[model samples]
Target: MLNLLQIEFHKMRYNRATKIFLIIYFCLFFSITLFSSIRFNLGEINFQLAEQGIFNFPYIWHFNTYFAAILKIFLALVVISMISTEYSNQTLKQNLIDGLSKKEFILSKFYMIIALSLASTILIFLVSLGLGLIFSDFNEINIIFSEMGYLGTYFLKLVAFFSFCLFLGVWIKRSAFVIGALFVWWVAEGIIKGILTFRKQKYGIKDQISQFFPLEAMNNLIKEPLTKLGIVKSSIGVVNDVNIYWYQILIALIWTFIFVWGAYFLIKKRDL
Candidate 1:
C-alpha cells in the first residue's frame, strides 16, 4: 500500500497538469499579496484608520474570505484533473491489473486530495500572514489567525467538493465534460439562485434552493466574518445565526462518504 501511494505521488509530481495547477495556484496567491502590499504602501490605505478600529479587522477578514473563495475554484480544477487524467490515460486500469486493490487505489487518490487541500490552505495562510506583516504593523496577524479557525471546516468542504468532482470524472470518463460541467454548475446555479431571489416578493425560497448546492454549502462552511459586506441573510435564510463550521463539517462528511462510496461501488461492479 505504501509503495502504491509512493508511485501515485511520483506520478502526480510529474504530471504536467498538476504542475500547471501549482503554478496557477502560486500566481493567484502572489497576485493577491502584491495588490494588497501595493495598496498599503501607496498611502491609499491609512494604517491609522485600521488601527483606530474602524475597518482594520474587517479589511483583513474580507481579504482572507475572498482569497479562499478564489482558491476554491482552482482547487476544484486540480481535483477534477487528478482523477480524470488517470482514467483518461488508462493508467488506473493498468494499476488495477498490477495487483493494486480497488480500495487502495481509491483511498490513495482520496488521501492525495486531502493532502493537497490542506497544503494549499496552509500555503495561502502563510503567504497572507507574511503579506500582513510586511504591509502593516497593526497586529493583523492575530486577526488572520482568528479567521483561520475556519480552515478545518473549509478543508472538509473541499474534500466533499473534490469527491463529487472525482465521481463525476469517473462516471463520465471525459475530461472536457467534467471540467465544463463543474464551471457550468458553479456559474448557472449562482445565477439561477440570484434570479430566484430577485423574483421573490418576500420569501427566500430560491436562496434556500441555492444553499443546497455544493459550492454554496462549501462557502458557508468557511464563513468569514469579514466578507459579510452588510449582506445579513445567508442563502439558506440562516441569517447571522448560522453556524457554518458545524454545517460544513456535517454536510461535507455526509456527501464525501456518499460520493466516494458510490464511485467505489461503481468501479467494483464495472469493467474499466
Candidate 2:
C-alpha cells in the first residue's frame, strides 16, 4: 500500500496537467489577493465598520466561498481525469496486472485525492491570511486562525465532492461525460432547486423534497447565507448560522465512503 501510494504521489507530482493546473491556481490566487488588497487599501471595500480589527467574517467567507470554490471545482476535474485517463489509456490494467492488488490501486488514488484536497484547503487558508494582513490594520494572523476552525469542514466537503466526481468518471469511463455531467449538475441544480422551492412553497411541500439533492447537504459545510434554506433572516449577518457542523461532517464522510467504495467496486468488477 505504501509503495502504491508513493507511485500515485509521484504520478500526481510529475503529471504535466497537474503542473499546469498548479500554475494557474497560483496565478489566480495572487491575482485575487492583490485585487482584494487593493480594494481594501483604496477604501473601496469595507468589510468591517472598524478598520482596527481584522476584516469581518463576511469578507473571509465571501473570499473563501466564491474564490476557493472555483479552485475546488478545477481540482475535482483534475482528480476525475487522473483516474479516468488511466482507465481510458489502459494503464490502470497494466498496473493491476503487474502484481498490485486492486485494493491498493484504489486506496492509493483515494489517499492522493484526500491529500490534495487538504493541501488545497491549507493553501487557500494561507493565502487568505496573507491577504488579510496586507489589507487589514488589525492582527490578521489571530483573526485568520480564529476562522481556521472551518478548514477541516471545507477539506471534507472538497474530498466528498471530488470523490463523487471520480466515481462518476470511473463508472462512466469517459472524461467528457464526467465533465459534462458535473457542469450540468453544478449549474442546473441551483436553478432547479430555486424553482422547486418556489413551487413547493405555494403548495406547502418545501420540506419533503429539499434533502434529495446532494449539493444541498454538501453546501451545509460552507454555510453561504444567500444559498441557505430554512429560517430566513431579515437582517444581514456575516456569520454562519447553521449548527450542523457535525452533521455536515458526517454527511461528507458518508458520501466520500460511498463514492470511494463504489469506484473500487466498479474498478474491481468491471473488465479493464
Candidate 3:
C-alpha cells in the first residue's frame, strides 16, 4: 500500500498544477477561521457572525462541517485533474507498460482519495474544536463532545464525492467533460427527485426513494446549519431538525462502492 501511494505521490510531486491546486485547497480550508471575525454595520443594523453563536460547542461541530463541505469543489479539481492528466500525458499507459497492475493503479488512486478525505476531516475537526473551546458557553465534556458525528458525516461526504469524481475522471479522461458530466448528473438528479416527490402526493410513491440517487444521497448526509443560528433560534423558537441521518450515510457508502468499482471495471475492460 505504501509503495502504491508512493508511486502516486511521485507522479503528483513534480506536477506544478497539482502542487498549486493542493496548496490552494488547504489554504481555503484554513480560511474558514476568518468567519469568526465577520462583521457588518449598516446604519442601525449591526451584525456580527461571531455573536450568532455559530462557534458554540456541539453546534460548532455541525456548523463547521457543513461549511467545510462547501469547499470540496476546490479539492475536487485535484482529483479530476489527477486522473485526466494521467491520460493526457500518456502516463496511464506508461504505468501499465511498466508492469503496474490495473488493480494496483486503482488502489493507488483510491488510497489517495481516503488520505485526502481523512486529512480534510482531521483539519476541520481541529478547527471546530479550537473555535468551540474558545467561544462556546457550555464547557462540560459531554456538551463539547456531543454531535461529533458530523465529522464522520463530513468525511463520508468527501470520500463519496471524490470517488465519483475519480470515476468520471477515468471514464471520461477529460477534465472539462468530467465537470460537465457532474453538472448534468446533478441536474438530472434534481429533476428526478422533483418528479418522485410529486408522485408521492398522487400515486402514494415513497419520497424516500429519491434519497437513493447518488448526489441526493450525499447531500442528505449533511443538512444546512444556518437555521441553527442564535438570532434565528431566538426569533423562530426551536425548529425540529435532525442534523444527521443514518440512511443518508448508508446510501452514500453504497454509491462510493459503486463509483470505485465502476472505475475499476472500466479500466479493466478498456483496450488501453
| Candidate that scores best on TM-score | 3
lDDT per residue (tens digit) for residues 103-132 in model 2: 888888888887888788878777766656
Q: TM-scores for all candidates?
A: 0.78, 0.81, 0.92
lDDT of 1 by residue, 142-202 (tens): 6645655555665676677788887887777687899888778889878987787887746
Alpha carbon lDDT of each predicted model? 0.67, 0.70, 0.88
Where is model 1 poorest over a 10-residue stretch in terms of lDDT?
49-58
Clashing pairs in 3: none
lDDT of 2 at 51: 40
Model 3, span 42-151: residue lDDT tens:
99998877667888888888888888898899889989999999899988899999999998999999998898899999999888888778778788999999888899
Please give me the total number of clashing residue pairs in predicted model 1. 0
Q: Going through the candidates in order, what is the number of backbone clashes in each?
A: 0, 0, 0
User: What is the RMSD of candidate 2?
Assistant: 4.5
Task: Output the worst ten-in-a-row residue range by lDDT, candidate 3.
Answer: 239-248
Stretches of candidate 2 exceeding 4 Å from the true structure = 40-54, 57-66, 137-144, 225-243
Error of 1 at 187 (Å): 4.1
Prediction 3 global C-alpha lDDT:
0.88
